[model samples]
Target: MDMFEDDTPGNAPEFTVSELSGAVKRVVEGEFAHVRVRGEIGRVSFPRSGHVYMDLKDDRSVIAGVIWKGVASRLETRPEEGLEVVVTGRLTTFPGQSKYQLVIEDMAPAGMGALMAMLEKRKQMLAAEGLFEASRKKPLPFLPEVIGVVTSPSGAVIRDILHRLRDRFPRKVLIWPVAVQGKTCAPEVARGIAGFNAMTPGGALPRPDLIIVARGGGSLEDLWGFNEEIVARAAAASEIPLISAVGHETDTTLIDFVSDRRAPTPTAAAELAVPVRGELLAWVAEQGARLTRAQTQAVETRGRWLRDLSRALPRPETLTEGPKQRLDYLSDRLPNALRGLAQRRRVTLSERGALRPALLRGRLAEEGRRLEALSARLRPALDRAVTAKREALGYRSDRLSLRPISRDLARQKGDLAETLARLSRAGEADLRRRRDRLGAAERMRETLGYKATLRRGYVLVHDGEGQLLRSRDAAAAASGLRLEFADGNLELGEMPARPVEEGGDPAASKAPTPQKPAAKAPRKPAKDEPPSGQGSLF
Candidate 1:
């Protein structure tokens, strides 16, 4: 054991590895309780645990540092490799590794030069990632129903925005309170943008159509929160058009590079959100007046052209003047023309006469003799025809008689009566047969009824409501029972107790104690007959 031992230092107390590390940790933390280290970051790492681990180094010396999950999330700026930062924290030891490191509580860019350099580096990275692409930016709403402003609620920025909006066109504004320039500013601003986007559009708290991220003018360090990568990404990803108004006109941040629009100040953002109501109304009135004048002139022009076209047409009476003159001339010459024509026709008839007076008398006498001869011949023929017709009529009258007709009618009447009598007998027999069948069916139905079963010593037990109690348990549970027999129905006031077994006392087993069934309202009788027009039961 002596050979394995090392030379001991003088006046030194023994300590385990944990004990030594703990002592060194206490000493370093006591000496540098609050320190500000200025160095460029190296080998930065962010784990899924949300803790940030990095190396703070200058020319030759390097110290390991860590910002825990809580501090990391609230930090306005992230630790980046090669970025110069001023860290405020206390020195502490890692006992597990027997080494010392800084437990950083706060972190920021070292100076204005470092901040601008960090901003330019971040801008280049985001630009390369297409976050600043013009195509991704949404167009601003011409007039938003609700405008959301993300800024400090107590700050002058919100008041300025509200005043500007009211002066132009009044709109509902949703103010998301946030710290504008601190460790929590970036996270709060990012969350505010996301919260507005997450709201349901037509809900009780209406979603804003346009979002304005605003803050009062401040130095570059005060405005550094808006330059955070998280805030820039949130602004770029907003579905609602976002306007960035973080500082004065000369001031710009990473958010302005990615936002849909950029305003110089909060008031300017409000102006961009809406237009003057009075000016809009004036423009609309002017357009309406111009449309009215154009319509009136068009109608008047059409009327004047129609009036000019009508001047070329002639008068109505002139169209019929020639026809009336021809009618008058024809009326004047009609009677004289008719008289002349009649005189010419009479002369023509006298010149062309076929017979003289003597010849005419001879032809008349000859025609009279011819007519008399025809009359003399026709009279004899007519008399003979009359005699033959008389004979034919007498013979026909003798041949036709009423006796045959009367005989035929009498025979038909007798046959009809016999047929009617046969039909009556057949109808009566059919009715009797049907009556016998129906009677047999009625007797069979009665034989097959429940009363027959009762007569054979099977009693039907029914509950108070007339439903059959088919089991012993059911009968025992019932309040009252009806015993239906062939003779009559008997009602019991109460359900009987369970009967004893054969091996029990003979007296208790002898009979079920008679239960006085409780009085119950009687149920209506059920229908017995089937519906009409059904097929024969048989």
Candidate 2:
């Protein structure tokens, strides 16, 4: 057994370290170069030169790997520890260290089996944070001034978005390109969103008013980077509004859940950014038609206002001044009416004054004339009546006076005629007759006287009392006696004797005395006397 092991034909003899490394390098470059392998990543490091260094392994074995700066920068993501990946690179060996490893160029997810496990875990964490809630989503702006886009720079998604936006609305657009998948793809997407926000410090973007994250259609494992919590939270915290257009219609990511708006694809996301050009042009035409109608209505209002102003202006003089004309007419008529009334009153006053005085004076003069004529006519008749009464009285008085005187003259004439007739008839005889009558008358007168009676022989005797003796009884005896004879009276010397008583003394009584007797003439004797009639007998 020792002799066979030492003299081995199939196995070569032992050499220096450089010779061993030289052989492995030839094999790696020649035969097993440019191959793809599936493994999990472990022990990752990014050096200062921007190259990525890590290990690729399975549960049984491990391998070293390197990605250069230029190639790694072009990768969709960085490789990490414990991540399942598909690496596209060639096996290589370092001659200085005498080590054999992998030089990575490109990679992808390992498989559906590995990707599903990681996606399910990340989806649960986002759901717990409420990022998948429908309520957290924002509505898209109707008209945006700036629009944002996120995709690979060389992808068809960005070209399609620009074409649609320029045609619809010529507003601005901003781009933030990032890797959409692999180990470090979530962090790169988050950085792209953050960079877009940083360009607008005060929420004013230089490129977009709204943000859109976009990519072409892919499998669920390829879209896993958008489902990461870091990418979702970056989208949610963006000040600008976010729109997600990640993959195909069936693709739903955590970024889509937190975005302000979600579109089914990249083309649809462009439509949300602006309006349609054809519809906007039509709307402008309709507003022009409305402007024409308003102008016409304003003209009609002005015309009506002018018509009303014309009606309100002042009227003509002929229509408005009727009252003033009536006032002038009354003014002209008033004075004449007053003057006519005054003249009528003056005439009435004169007529009444003249008629009253004329009537009174005429009556007075007529009455005076009538009274004077009546007085003159009565004076002659009164004078005639008075003269007639006086003449009648004088005639009656003369008749009475003449009757007495004539009666007296007639008686005297009768007496004188009777005397004359007697004288003529017997002058002597008449004388004698007259003498005889006288003598007879003388005788009769003598008979009445005592002395003449004595001549006729008559005597008277008286008693002593001197009374003619009518009776003896009436004489006193003692009284003296008286005797009357035809021629004279005789006184007795003593009382005549009387009869007495016989016894008386006769001597003492009266004595008889002698007295001369009265002388008597011869008396005529009466026939009856006796012869002794010489003495008174008794």
Give lDDT per model, in order: 0.81, 0.72
lDDT of 2 by residue, 1-538 (tens): 4322567676746767887677768867899778998999889998899989899999999999999998997876447566699999999998877777899999776777666655676667777888767786667788987776777878889999998888888777777778766756788788888888778444544746688899888877688788766788899888778889999888888788788888999889989888997898889887887787788778666655655654564444433256446645755665565455555655665666766766655654564455445545644554565456446545644543445545755876898999998887779787888999999998896566435445677666664444465545444453555666654556653445555446877576755667756434334345433223233334
Question: Candidate 2, after superposition: displacement of residue 307 in Å?
Answer: 4.2
Candidate 2 residue 481 C-alpha distance from true site, Å = 99
In candidate 2, what residue range of length 10 has the lowest lDDT sum? 528-537
RMSD of each: 30.8, 80.7
**How many residue pairs clash in all the candidates, one count each?**
6, 4
Q: Give the Cα-based TM-score of candidate 2 against the true structure.
A: 0.39
TM-scores of the candidates in the order shown: 0.53, 0.39
Q: Give per-residue CA lDDT, model 1, range 189-253, as digits (tens).
A: 99999999999989999999999999989898899889999999999889999999999999999
